[model samples]
Target: MKTSIYATLAAVAFALPAMAQDMGDAANGEKEFRKCKACHMIQSPDGTDVVKGGKVGPNLYGIVGRKAGSQEGFKYSDALVKLGEAGEVWTTEDLAGYITDPNKYVEEKVGDPSLKTKMTFKMAKNQADVVAFLAQHSPDAGAASAGDAAEKPATN
Candidate 1:
């Protein structure tokens, strides 16, 4: 019993870092988003353009917490749609990993080795930053508290 308890504790400790990624600097993410401009854009529901760019990819407004492949009319690959159907909701950590390697991420999620994404570009270095920027624009951060809602004014 003692050995098992120790092993469990050790496993939990090691897993903490992978579970809780450090929050990236949203300001830096804004700067890093320039690279994403070639294929994506951030346009709000009210037709306000946050970052005007190409439309090769889906509009990234409110992508955080959104169901994978849920962007209406975007025509995501079947693997992505299946992943979403399997209850994959986008979290900041998952988004960071996905942006680092889309095909790999989708493959891992869908448990299919042959799956690929239309996204060819990868943001390897500033992935966390870009995710942070996207989170800022996410109107429906699924895990956020009412106090954390964007409509609420920051206290500090």
Candidate 2:
């Protein structure tokens, strides 16, 4: 009985970090999102502007749970399109990593060092916060949050 209890405890401990992926503070994320505004905008399909921003990047209204590089009207890099073709979907955890290092993430995902992203800026900190903010605008927010929790590796 004691051994079984210890095994259960250990399992729970290992699962905690995966469960915490969607627990980022959305309020703080909104503040951290200012850094992303210069390139991206959060606009709804019905023309509602959640956060008015630039057109340099695609509209981020439904980014969470979206397939990478699948946003209409945005010309994506070949690398991004290839990643999407390889079944890459945008989850909060993946988005956080993408923001931290788009180039490296693309390279890793596509296994091509020559592939590069159009995005030059990188968000090294407050990634979870920003992803949470983006998630709030996502139409499939619940799905993105829940799916990501199951799919992402444990984070420190």
Candidate 3:
């Protein structure tokens, strides 16, 4: 009985912290994501850029479910294209990893050797904030019920 009680308490304790994380507000994320405006444009009908509005990188409007490097008109490195062809789809976790270290994630995930993705951009060190912003702001983040309502449960 003691062991069971302790286990129940442990489980509740673990769940409490997870329940406490704020999923963030998109409106707030839009403001916070302003810092990223230099590099990324998350648009719905069309994307805009302050820095020449040119297509240096792919449009990220629907990036949440999009395959890596699969934007229609943009040119992607062979590595990213290969990742797309391999049936890899972008999820929030993948986006978070990319936000943390684009080059590293591409290097580790892309199987193509000849083509290297060169996104060396680093998000602010506080990736949780970035992730929250991404999740909240992206139009294609998909199936939103509530903040992080669809989020996968935290794993040990």
Instruction: Estimate the Cα RMSD of every predicted model relative to the unseen true structure.
Output: 8.3, 5.4, 6.3
lDDT of 1: 0.79
Q: Deviation in angstroms for 101 in model 2? A: 0.2
- Please provide TM-scores, in order, for all candidate models, with all chains considered together: 0.78, 0.79, 0.63
Cα lDDT tens digits, model 1, 28-120, are 888999999998999999999999988888999988778899988898888788779878888777888888888999888889978788889
lDDT score for residue 5 of model 3: 100
Model 3 segments beyond 4 Å from truth? 1-32, 46-54, 111-115, 137-156
Stretches of candidate 1 exceeding 4 Å from the true structure = 1-21, 142-156
Residue-level lDDT of model 2, residues 1-156, one tens digit each, is 999999999999998756555456677888988988998899999999999999999899878878999999999999889999988889877998999999999999889999988999998788887887787777675565564433332221
- lDDT-based ranking, best first? 2, 1, 3
Tens-place lDDT digits, model 3, residues 80-113: 7777777767766677677776666776776434
Model number with the top TM-score: 2
How many clashing residue pairs appear in each of the predictions shown?
A: 0, 0, 0
Residue runs of model 2 more than 4 Å from their true location after superposition: 1-22, 147-156
C-alpha local distance difference test of each model: 0.79, 0.82, 0.59
For model 2 the local lDDT of residue 147 reads 48
Location of the lowest summed lDDT over 10 successive residues in candidate 3: 147-156
